[model samples]
Target: MKIRFPMRASVAACALCAATTLAPASPVAALGPTGGGPGAIVRPEATVPQPAVLYGEGTQVRLRSGAHAVPDVTALSWVVADAASGEVLAAHDAHRRLPPASTLKTLFALTALPAFPGGIRHTVSAKELLGIGEGSSLVGVVEGHTYQVADLWRGVFLNSGNDAVHVLAALNGGWEHTARQMEDKARSLGALDTTVVSPDGYDADGQDSSAYDLAVFGRAGLRDPDFARYCSTARAAFPGTEGTFQIANTNRLLTGADGVAPYPGLIGIKNGYTTNAGNTLVAAAHRSGRTLVVTVMHPQAGGHAVYEEARALLDWGFAAAGHVDPVGSLDALRPVPRGATTGAKPKTAVVASTGAPRPAEPDWTQTGTIAGAAGLGAGVLLLGLRFRYKRASRA
Candidate 1:
């Protein structure tokens, strides 16, 4: 079955395989993984200040009188922004890069989730499960067990399992390929502060992200239905060798586990902890049709600080909306034109809740050819695997 690309498409459809993917450089494409070489797309330089003037080292918020001040917390980096309008309400060291821990999985899910359909089943191989980080969390996915793609995703969200991530990466090609794709996706989203050294968000020597970039990920993930569902799920049944077992989400604020009081209207994005990264969280909540996303990274207060800080920010954001102007924006920086003259500065456009000329839409005719062909190739491979999986199941 052939797929047709709709004009003004949010995602592109490949003619060769009945599938759609982020169509090249579309706005949605900028938010997810694409089928392209790691360096195929030119990105803004990391040093280039995004949302202009967001590089300031201290807190950035213009509070009017009678509005309570944002809570003082020990987070090294944090940001709170309007999800729909992309207006950053307040931020502190928003661009400061720090270790990301498992929170990097948000980017991973954005990149890899669309590549596999949930009903597709993949058998775990010993080799596929190899190279999981030592001391990393596991979902107890035994080798030789076959799992519906959905089950593995549950393992990832609920248990933060590196083993499940490895299996999914193997399906997407391999760890290195998925990591490179993640890097490409991050740049596409204008998350310039993140460096993807590991696809599973394990603490590698240089893997890192910043509050601004992480909030960007959370906002983008909400655009996808599957990404939203998986993260918000509080519990799920994961298949194991012995039997199916229940796993609860590690996001304390979402599940109200670990003595943390659940925040009303909380939406699960992700949470992470590692010796190097400390505690990191990306959380979103909706009240009165307005949604806010918050990112807290490497808080010094320890235990529950990440969740509490995020909760406090959300409260402040909802109340502070319209009372304050955006400190910055979450809009992705425009990519350099493919063959622009060397050293030409890329245009820095900011999308705010206030009226501003939005960035120009990418010319799909010019860019879609390459992305469509790439999507076609990926679609074929995935379809073949699905057919094989079905045949094996029926045998």
Candidate 2:
């Protein structure tokens, strides 16, 4: 189905103006418990505090004995983490960088989710329909097809579609803007080692990430309800097309009826493969109410081998830890050392120097008022000019 997207100048202008107006308010709403604005949250400690029993001498020996070993995994690296607690269950070259292939699309989908309006209908442009010819997979989105933003998300996760990624990038702004946004989003999410050069991971230079970073991205992506729904689909119909396109999930474990044995609670995640980065898989599984995420890159065998290794690691985790919750209540644990007492009256600040009161300086309200008036005047003049131009063209 062909779709034509009509870009109305007035609508675009209004959207830009609205975004500019609301941008400042966003930071205020992101404030933390300390009442500091966005980006002011206290940094997490570098090392987790281990229990005295666990930290005692020779405890490291016990940890080594309990470590799970992966088989047929040739990747320079791998990482398995607890989804709930964010604990590293296993690591083999986890920090080593490797091409993520379509797995990078997971980051792209997540970073763009907040920018897109839910349930909004967007027409696919001709430029977005053309797929990169670099041997990457595509969902066959044709030019001039109108679809909801939600459907584009399905294309990204279900089919690992490069074309769907392009459409999403265009929807956000463009390739350059989308790439920068992806980097910023990754940094904000604390995936410090990640770098995204392309919206679709198509073997582009500098477009690589570590297995550890991919696992982090997967965990964050799974948190979104829409993203989880799209990735978990065994099959879905692509709307606005001639025939219903059957999308088989790339994760093979989702295909089998018997739910990947030994693992017992495998949930859908993502898979990727390329010459530079051998078969890569990010698998998530749940058992006894605890969820674990495993990432394998450049596996010795195919994708299935990686899945089997992940299943083994998950089994070991469940057997050993037995669903120990990682997080604890801050209030129940310890309190900050600030002078203000908990639930106490606000303390008044006393100036050390004794001096006569000076007249308060003139407030800047008048200057601000003048600036606001000038800005309003300029907006009115621009609108008048646009209206006049439209009227003249109509005449």
Candidate 3:
């Protein structure tokens, strides 16, 4: 379908004129202690802090004895999940809120990609590029030009371009509208920690997502054929006056940049970095016909920690695929107006956690692969902590 996107100049002017808008805030008093029953959503986490492995409320990864060579990455939050089943194999600080950087684009793709056909073309305006913040990753586009929806998407996936995302958002309506829609999509996917504010994932105050939520995004994005194709693209090119502007995929796991061996089953997802967010990544890999998705967020700087950390998790997930038990499965979100769909599984509720440090064990009692808990001044909710409202842009 052919759709008209907003003029760049007008969009830029609107961006400049904007004031700080508050997020959808929930009443602190209305939130009860963490725990849920049938029809409840649960997000799990570790109460006692672990330095390396994920220690949240969900099931733990079971590595075969003498099979543990995974590096301890400095990333603050990360999760490894089986792609087909959405089962979380292992995670560290999986539910902690952290800057998402470009990985949030996976969410945008989930919400916006299937809306526009690949061949659709739109004019580019100088003003549109202005809407992207300074130091934001860009897929170079000239103002007063035109390009196809596919090209814009290529820019987004290959280069982590804020410019490409802005143009696409304009096609969806505007930044404000697209942001709200992306967040709504996050809700439907059972990504409770995500509060999207920018479609391109530019770092913004109050913009945040958890490692587990990112895995949710990757899983949902991969389900769409177009999203999977775009992310897996190893290289893409855009038309330009001087010449064809070509770029390699930013995902090193796919392209093998920085000397890291290209993973055999690496699939494209997305990756991002900013001062606040450090390095973040969402990647999926297939091995022996089994697919797994790994999300690593806020890794400490220096080497390719984001990619390496993700690589380690992927290796472990493939090795541990069937041998160990799943601590939890990332639930497909129940359709809103809960149970509206026939045979849709009811959102399961989790009982409140003790909120104390303890040894990690199978989450048999947590109820249904426990996921989110609401904030009560720092008390950990055992599972889905559904907040009434409140409110990812790049870093």
Candidate that scores best on TM-score? 1
Candidate 2 has which clashing residue pairs, if any?
2-144, 3-144, 3-145
Order candidates by lDDT, high to low.
1, 3, 2
lDDT (10s digit) by residue, model 2, range 12-129 = 6655664564343231134356556655665544233332222122111124454443334455567666665566644666557788887888888878887786599888878865
Model 2: runs farther than 4 Å from truth? Answer: 1-72, 257-263, 322-395
Give a tens-digit lDDT track for model 3, residues 348-369. Answer: 1111111121223333334232
Single out the weakest 10-residue window by summed lDDT for candidate 3.
348-357
Pairing residues by index, what is the TM-score of model 1?
0.74
| Top lDDT hit | 1
Question: Candidate 2, residue 213: CA error in Å?
Answer: 0.8
TM-score of each: 0.74, 0.64, 0.70
Report clashes for each candidate as comma-separated counts.
0, 3, 34
List model 1 lDDT by residue over 113-169, tens digit each.
999999998888899988888889888888899999999998888899999999999
Error of 2 at 281 (Å): 1.3
lDDT of 1: 0.81
